[model samples]
Target: MGNDGSGAGDGTKATEDAESTQVYRTFRRARDLLLTHREDYAAAREEFAWPEFAEFNWALDWFDRIAAEERNAGRPALWIVEEDGADNRWTFSELSARSNQVANWLRGLGVRRGDRLILMLGNQVELWETILACMKLGAVIIPASTLLAPADLRDRVERGAARHVVVRDADTATFADVAGDYTRIAVGERVPGWESFADARTAEATFSPDGVTRADDELLLYFTSGTTAKPKLVRHTHISYPVGHLSTMYWIGLEPGDVHLNISSPGWAKHAWSNVFAPWNAEATVFLYNYGRFDAAGLMEQMDRCGITSFCAPPTVWRMLIQADLTALRNPPRKVVGAGEPLNPEVIDQVERAWGVTIRDGFGQTETSVQIANTPGQPVKPGSMGRAVPGFTVALVDPVTGQPASEGEICLDLRSRPVGLMTGYAGDDERTEAAFADGYYHTGDVGTIDDDGYITYVGRTDDVFKASDYRISPFELESVLLEHDAVAEAAVVPAPDEIRLSVPKAYVVLADGYQPDAATAESILAFARKNLAPYKRIRRIEFADLPKTISGKIRRVELRGRENTKGDSRATTEFREEDFPSLRG
Candidate 1:
């Protein structure tokens, strides 16, 4: 047997097959160990090791094997419920066969090994099918968001060197101006110049790889959210995401047959993190509730009706969820986690009171998987994002000294490089070298570590500033502001001051039923003064929507720029602390 699905191969191929089997067994052993010690974080960290392999194809080896097993083949692998009351489900066996057909069809259309393909689609069945098919076919995938306009599409097509694009039929027009020779394939209704994704149904249901896939082969290219600057291309190998997500599975506490719901949009790294790799790695069902607009009550209904056992959501969604009637759902998920940003303590406290499950926070980036997290059964300290996950060695390095410290930049020690980390920034060797320089992958984010090894996020290196010569963490002040009822969301940036070099200014988004008036500003400012230190208090507030990346991360860089250019002038919406005499203590 060979990796190419040929039986009774020559001596070299037979030897290759034996190596492949050993790799599979080693990977399975690691996965099973984590599952066994799911709640025992200490045992898991001390025992777990990343499986090493020379040649490995996760889709061909792991997923296909699980699909053929009698115990797992019939289990539901994907469950999607739409807002219009449409429901669809697919078993492991079905997706395996469907992906095979898609692979064969794609190969016929010149999608060969090493070809770069842009996958832009919603939470549809075709997305999963195509992803599996691409893996089997040994094609590199560049996942793009549908919200991208023509200019953004052009950047991906040109910079990514994409050889093909599979997107929604309606979006085909956006590509008209994106000049490229890439093959166009559209889902949904037919387009004149584009191949219909529906045609895959008529292709052969059995497929075979043309050659063996090395574990180090390029697999996924993700564009960073670009909160501060232009998006950088992050590259991952075949083993990095597929095998490395074992840490993610353990962090989420996923188990076999568990139905997990992760609230995220397609075309982002987090979507693949939870929606595809993490859940499937644990042999759990990936459940999704697709909606045009986020309705907290409606989403809760689906979670109850579908029996979602594990849930993962961003901090933004978690904040909105708390505003709704949380008790409407009869059953809440047993396992819950928050990512994308450091969740506020107030939000976590509210969720725990309503549902009895603490919202554990995990920290990572587009460059890596969950590096630090509050794992299952761990004592989650308020405002801390837990400890280093298994298989990762995390350190806080002082920026000036470049040495390990108690409070500094959060970094990953590359002495034992984790499997979930990306290879480097694609097409930019200089940036890649800078990131991996000094024997550590600098995360560009700052944090503090306690005596117990728990790491709490402070803020991005560029986002942290000084106020009256005292270090100011915007996240800390924003957390206090979020504790107020008048604040739906808040962002803090440094504003120029004459007496003190700079002062903390807050941009607040009022919650429902709250007016963005002088009274509301005073209430929020007074609350911050009561909770935070005087130096960290929000001295000025402006009621306005936060500027964010399309991925929903607040772009504090933009707010900082706005404040710098404003000089001494004040906007109509701005309110200063001096305007209220009562708040002066």
Candidate 2:
């Protein structure tokens, strides 16, 4: 697929070029439609349609074309802020030229079309450049985190069939024991027998694709976070992510020239969602604040100084931010959002009270972009994750009857597949088929849609349990527990019981200045009793750190296992309500 123009005078060349033009027009029309109705969610949902593309490369067709425009030529596309107070901003034209050079340099190093490359870098300029260069060359990317150990690297290298690797100099040693014939390229300081990424500067600035990029060509491969089980490889086509993040742009209320900051790790899907695709799709600047440790006050000061307009973070960060001084920053971002996990009403209420802006919550997965989100100018119900975004049809199905129900499994209709949905789990036909069963893509999550179409998230299908024949959503109990003063984080799971089959038990993480003594346990238990239903009451409390997956999600499966192995016994750390006299009538 080298840009040799071998078919310069052939009829096939003419047809391919014309088809590419048509694809670009269709994509632009769809993008412009969303921008036109940015605030009108109802109208946007009713009129929006996913654009069809036969052959397209987003970097070549959309981003490059826009970079040449006078309006966006000198506009900043990427802005990186360092913890040491150093910052750098790259304009649209600069990045376009830089990525072209990188693409040319990589091609010289035997990086061919369809070759899988593992990119493990932090928030830096080269990371963004490589993403665009890979897209231009039609090479598939497997983004791994720098935090992965050698064992994890082996899994990615073997399972992903990686042909090339781009990593920092410090992390090069992690792959020393990883057996592979792949090309090693180091980004920082020169390494022995490894290609230096800095050499790209000497390469030619002009770039040409070997051939047209098909819309359905594999582009990104993501490994799931393994919160419940082993990580699954998810494959996305070119159009799935590059063009599908319009929903995310609309969700964040992004506009041209706006600086958008999203707190997420490099390897995760959320990073791609906001850091690259969504911001660029809206012609906005992607802003990053690199820090070793999270400091809420320092982050707010940067946001205030940099004039950030839109912000998105996980619920964990939002929870941490509220614990600090919410009034630190004189100017809060106009658009604030939380995801990765459901945001509790208590956290949302605190932020709204302090900043005068509601924290919108959105629901999605690694397999797709923002499927359901609280869009701009919409009334955010306290805990609802809003209605389905444009181009998605959400349904709730009963687990037992296999029929549509008001409260059951949250799923997506496959009759009209959303462009953001992944192609499939690569090499896992059984899992993919099961996911697409019943003419829907099962999300493995449960939710209830109100009369007005606002969907409130129930716990995961596996996490939701029954106590005394009453359905209990752990999220509901956790949210109530978060409202208490002493509780910082809570994970509720079912404990074995003879009469009720199972009983509600909570593993709590105490807040600052709070103790794990009897006084504190009684107060938290008393608060739960008042706020929760009788059936959902916490029968026992354990003041300890909750176990979580590497991606920061609570691992209730492990906690459930701990309960199952108890065998009619209690741990020494556990404090039962029966042991407290304050709960006795």
Candidate 3:
């Protein structure tokens, strides 16, 4: 859609303008309701409703409006801290004007509405600018991690049908082998054939949309992390994330002027969830700390210095943070939450003991926003991922009988679809149909609901196995293993056994000052036996690094494969319960 250079006087334009205002107001009302009931989960659930919209552009109708507001205009919208102590901050009005210039610049380069653009950038100001600019231009964004290899880049370009690419200048050589007709744009030092992103600053500061963006118009296409199999393309509409993250904002307890720091890399959905949508939805500043390597102490220093009030991090980061000095920070964030994977109870306990704040757990997938979470001021049941957030109807469905159950596959009832849910798996009708079957959207994860409605996460449906006909959740055994001071991380999988079909086997990573010897394995196994039931005890243990996806999720699928192929011979590093006869009864 091209701007015909027409002035804003036509009847069609007038009607569209009125519709846009109506949708913006509707969105604001829903957001304000959640903010008002921040601590009152029951009231938020009772009063909240997803705003309906026929035509809406979040950047044009919502972000721009907020940017111009007197209260928010001068407030910092984004703050980035470098590892070397360098920092940059952008205000709401500054970003609004900057994104407009970028939008105008991109339009001049032939970028059009509905065109798919591959955005592979690190945590930098240009990343945020391109995001808003693309939204204003109605371009679909395909976010990619900088860690992706050239083959992965080719897959994204081909499968995503990308028309444009924006990446760091150092990564320009990566595209040399990835063949595409897409336009190339670089953010750092100018490349020979690539367009300079710095040129966007010289374009017009004022922006005009070529056409109206419908609420359901495609905005983002995310590729899953491929922890189990090939990555699936997940599609989201203009409203799904921009307006949908109110639940995430509520889950993180974000408020106006709050500085929220979420430890996540760009090119992933979690980045968009916390670093982009959730914090901004509440008019809070999105804070980022860029570092080449993870240093827990350094991160904490920045958090304290930045006056961060709300903090969200993946389970991996939380686990590492516990290994460092927890009391180093003079002031810990008041609001702490964990996602990506379930936080082990031990890690939560350590943080709570040090900071006097519990690490709330939230459950969701790439297909939707926060479905279940421990809201602020709620009694967080240990190991439970709280109740369903407002606007979502969560149920545990029996995979076989297709009926609601107290324990089964965690799913969302499609009868009343939540605005936060994705549209579908793009270009894969078979997968989409299967996911939306049985009147629900299957999360492919298992969980159990207690009488009080808190949901405890079981392992993935594929990861859960049986031993002696008794069901076993790998997460449960892993959690027990993590409780030991010698065990840093552990992944449990079934190994072939002569009797009982199979038995639980653990692949563990040792903590500092712990050796990877039989003595260490024996200590961990003994600790597990004392803590876990007999049926779920660790029958065998091996010291090794856990394989993980780029997003930092454990790949149990690979470990299961390794066990299936291990025909009876065990590695020298593996220790079996039978080898240690002293413990046998």
Candidate 4:
């Protein structure tokens, strides 16, 4: 009878511990499977499952657990290599201790669970430390770029409902006109009215959570880089980014002790994707090459010197790199990938010829981790973004018919919601509902899947237009334009035509030493005529710089508005393909 009573009394505590163990094991099991089958996509996708956990804190359960291990103690977790040779590296043990101290200090400053904090620092140690600290405290973080002006800062502070703000000392003056009741903490040199982040060093290095962190607790709130309209606030849970980046780790082909360098700015989701969660999750080193201006040769030199194994960059960087001498780098990374925009086939071919490795393409957004990618050991089809990664069910839903189609808007099936997906757009139920309507989470982007399950990117839904009743993907024309030697960058927009209703017009940014004159226009137009079909031929050409959003995406909305206004008269800088005699068929 006594044994039965004792069993009943201890049942709750024993069951709680067992549940915690189950959650940890489940998360680790999924992660290890991806790592084991890093090269075998068929087997991984067939047998992968996202682990569910009721109570989970990634920092405590995963990172701290790994930190305690003897193998990872002295290993470099974060390595920041600067251009001037003043590099910084933090071991797993040091970071784990530092974040504990920061968490304790932050809690003392009235940062409680569920409070939202604004982290607006540069690519410094404090940025990483604060992220870990916030996760430990279970405080939601709103990562803002340092490039934002006073107006944007006010919007984030107000709309984000931020209770605390951490920023660099140099940016403190910009906040003078800003009005907020949040606690202000400054990194770098001490500021007059701001609390010194350096003071956290004196706090104890052992932190105790006030309460258990639920897996669904809000962890991060990201303001999307505005390309079309005002940015949407993307909300992610503790599990969404922390535990959900196993796919990202697999997509990049990361392995333990590998030096992984990803070119991205802080405050962006990709920064956290590679710089923090993905690399750390794989027990790899997060390598950063900081520079004021991009020097492709300089970057390659650094990569060679540091022995960087895995690398990722945006299409913009890849385009600039192909412009330089591709053979400048002696050793290239085996695992190279591109994201942010679709990489042109021309750029991929150039890199493959120069280096032995092929640049794989990955597709995803701030709303989720990588949904589609050309993972390692796969047959990469040119222009295709490869198949859907494990844990995501991608469907191409026809916009008009609202049925599954071979080519349509890319969306994720909500019935089997992926763990990497965001909770919703914070404080915008209307927008959130619209995105998740029709039993799918619409991506606002368009794509087409082939018979082999490879997905090729079409342009954005708003950017795709029709010419002579035939749909035109601007990306297709832009890819062809990029193939030209004189064409540095190009954006194709629809021009109002009398007979065809609309025709394709390209805004060209000439390469160095290439003149933007009649001769250049004739050569470019003649080349386009030979390459493109008659229906997709270039009608108008403008030699002008393209307008880009702050996040570096071309603002086609602005270009479309400009084209609609200019009817017949060509601008002083504009050149029409009709002006070229050889272009006239």
Candidate 5:
């Protein structure tokens, strides 16, 4: 009896520890390889191996390995909290057991391998439960942010060919408009036509695998942010994301037992990129805090309290975070990274001054993982997104000449395809073929590379404009505009010009407590003219809100359209390079 009792206690403790510490160690092997080969991107891209598993389920294989090895060894697998102070922390082992229950329960409800399930929920426990359970059951997950409107839901249901939906109780009404013959399971109080997710807790904790999981099976279908055209359906294989975020693991500098908090919406690719895959790849704890509006101080407080070791946020969030007292938190994370868009150098400088830590920037999209990053333990070049990440072969292809150039559209070599590349845009073969033309996976975004191979921010090929025969990048002008004291935000777009064909027109949003007047305008225009070349000067100005897409990208296309039609609006202030003789000189 004593021996048996001791064994039970040890087993119990082992489960807890495995749930906490094991994931980090397992993720470290690949992280070590990434760091060691950071400088040798070509070799790493050629030689890197995706961890081979014959009977692999990332949740079962990698996560279970941690459980068997680590005994209460580290921390919880996931930690979430609300602004009101409600919180939940689940260990890896606990999550594993809970997921088993969810999987079994969902299976009983008729979920099967290859079944498409639309998971629409907020930052709640059901989201994680459904994610793991679906993974174990081999159900394809179409993650949806609760932010989607009912109309958007209909589009997703039809486009995804969904067979099941696991959603919040209140959100069930959304399906009233989105009709489908699908299994509807709701969390919280049971709604009519929806099964209660609460029942899953009663099922058996021990889950048995019904079949083998192929690494190449479709796991995630992303409805990308439609900046221009309709949202493209992006298909990600199990290994493509689960195993492919190894590059993201390297970019964020995640190590064993690190606590990583990535600021992103639940349904977006960036969320899965960090919260699920990258952290799990590094065995880092995924930390999340739910809030109504962004509170930079609150985020820093959470960072301090949680001892968050790594952080990643979009450039938009970083811009907001920098506006706050960045030094208030005495201890910042060991690593900080910016994504979504190229970061302005002004934001990086402020953070470095306050935190004594440089903010690293990286480049990638919904179509791929981290391709370029100013990584940990490396020198950061302001305005330059560092070298290409390990395992990605990047080339700058001149569109005009159809050859590699110092400045051109960034393309990935298809001959040496990285595991991080997407399978293709779902059901869009022609578009996919066009994307992979000329033995390269063209990224569409244009940038420049120096002799040393460091890539710098240039506007998108479509976004760049010519002013007096001098090409101007809106990002470049916008960066300079941000440095001025009167400017909170700025968007530079081409306005119609009778002589120069096109001249730089800047729409400025004044910083807090600044008045919009001729003085402020002259200050901004003078600052731009002084810093920029004569032809690249900001010739026209407007004080107005910048238009943005739903996903928060500046709609330069909209601004350009306005210039074409409403160029005569009295709101616009036109200045000529000749009007300012000093600028002409």
Candidate 6:
């Protein structure tokens, strides 16, 4: 995306002025309040306001304001570096203009309002440009990570009603089998049938919207992980993600012009939640380090060199980050966060010691933005995921009675109706009704809220097992296992048993000094039994790394499938709870 925001004055002056009067004033106040209470969660939630607007296009309206104003005029909107050392950075001004050019180009190529487009590309400048251009066009975007297989592509094309496709030249082969009436355009070199993206740079830099995007227009389509079934199509509207991510902006505590680098793949909802909308909404520069393989050392160097003010990664990256020397980087970012799942305290502690900053944890799903998080400047409970974001009202309902409880399924009240929520799962009305039943939108995951209003994530509703007729939260067990010297990481799943019906079995990874043998397993089991309730104690242990999804979440479904094949198939280093004689009583 490359042009002149001043050329021909495509966007009417009166419209721009009106946006400045009302919408921008509110944004300024919200942003001000977020910075003022960056450290206080309760204060921020109580005080923050979602910007009120009759009509808005974040790329056209808000981003343009920031560039014209002093706050983000010359600040980098996107900063990129390749492994080979070539790099370029786009200030907010440059990015906004470039997006106009791309928007004009895409319109010329038949991309229009409400038309669905599948965006698949690596971490390149065009990716960001296309995002802004699409937003300006009011088109629905389905973000696809380049890692997707042909099957995944076919699924998206069919399910999402894709009218256009924008992909990298390298990834064109994956689309060979995907049959659709969509326009094909590729970013790098010329593909046989696809139009060249290289033409976008030559297009005029100014673009005027055919009409103002309705705040409720469908903006994004996402395919969920679909563990028990096929991936569900999730839909988000104009204000749903763009404006609703004020919670995410506050959760990460990014300020205007701050360099924020969030490690996530391109296609996932989490990527858009943080990488595209949230950081840019905060007026923060999105810094990316493109690498083939994860290099913890190289990442740290980029952070230091670029002065990344805020950083975020999922538990998978955090797990690997701890394995590397934590203190290798000279300067660590001030604000850091972990998402995609609840992070272990060990990783948090290790990073704190090395960086002098605590790693805040956030929890949300594909259907919503960050609902629960440990906000900046808040008193973070050891394992708690902080508090509900500004626009969300969280309720932990009793699973049996649906009454408010300290620990239960994490649910959002439908009464207040936060904008961040999806328009319900696309094309599955029955499942959608179930998800939003009982005046609440139920998140399948379970969590506990304290008297101070902090919420701690428990395991998923199905993943939390019952052992010896006592409900045992797997996260509680996993937390205890992580405390053991020999334990690296663990996942507890129900293993079928003859007497108990099902028992808690841990799949674990050993720390550096330990091995997967009877002695190591016994020691860890002893440690768990000593630390846990008698009924909640882990009855079986397997010394092996936990299996996870591509996004790094523990695949309990896979483990559950393995247990189904056989009544109880033990791994090479399996140890029964009864193996240790210390608890014969």
lDDT of each: 0.92, 0.90, 0.92, 0.89, 0.81, 0.83
TM-score of 6: 0.94
lDDT of 2 by residue, 398-450 (tens): 98998888998999999989998998999899999999998999999999998
Provide C-alpha RMSD values for all models, in order: 1.3, 1.9, 1.7, 3.5, 5.5, 3.0
Task: List the candidates' TM-scores in order.
Answer: 0.98, 0.97, 0.98, 0.96, 0.90, 0.94
> Which parts of model 3 are misplaced by more than 4 Å?
1-6, 10-17
TM-score ranking from best candidate downward: 1, 3, 2, 4, 6, 5
Model 4 C-alpha lDDT per residue in residues 335-395, reported as the tens digit of each score: 9999999999999999999998999999999989999999999999999999999999999
Q: Candidate 1 regions off by >4 Å?
A: 6-19
- Candidate 6, residues 1-585, lDDT tens digits: the string is 111123325455555556545766676687778778887767877777677666767777677667667767767888988888778898888888898899989999999889999999888889889999999888999989888888888889998889999999999988998898899999999999999999999999868777767777889888886575688888888788888887888899988778889998888887888788888878888988899899999888888888889999998788778878879888889999999989888788889999899999998888998898888877888999988888799999998999989989999998888877888878889889999999999999998888998898888888887767888788878888887867767888888888888888888887677788888887887888898888877888887767765556788888777776865456678889777787456
Of 1 and 6, which scores higher on lDDT? Answer: 1
* Candidate that scores best on lDDT: 1
**What order do candidates take by lDDT, descending?**
1, 3, 2, 4, 6, 5
Q: How high is the lDDT of residue 466 in model 4?
A: 98
Instruction: Give every collision pair in model 5.
Output: 17-71, 17-72, 18-67, 19-92, 19-93, 23-283, 24-283
CA lDDT, candidate 5, residue 168:
89
Which structure is stronger by TM-score: 1 or 2? 1
TM-score of 1: 0.98
Worst 10-residue lDDT window for candidate 2 reads 1-10
Task: Give the range where candidate 5 is weakest over 10 consecutive residues by summed lDDT.
Answer: 1-10
| Model 5, global lDDT | 0.81
Error of 4 at 253 (Å): 1.0
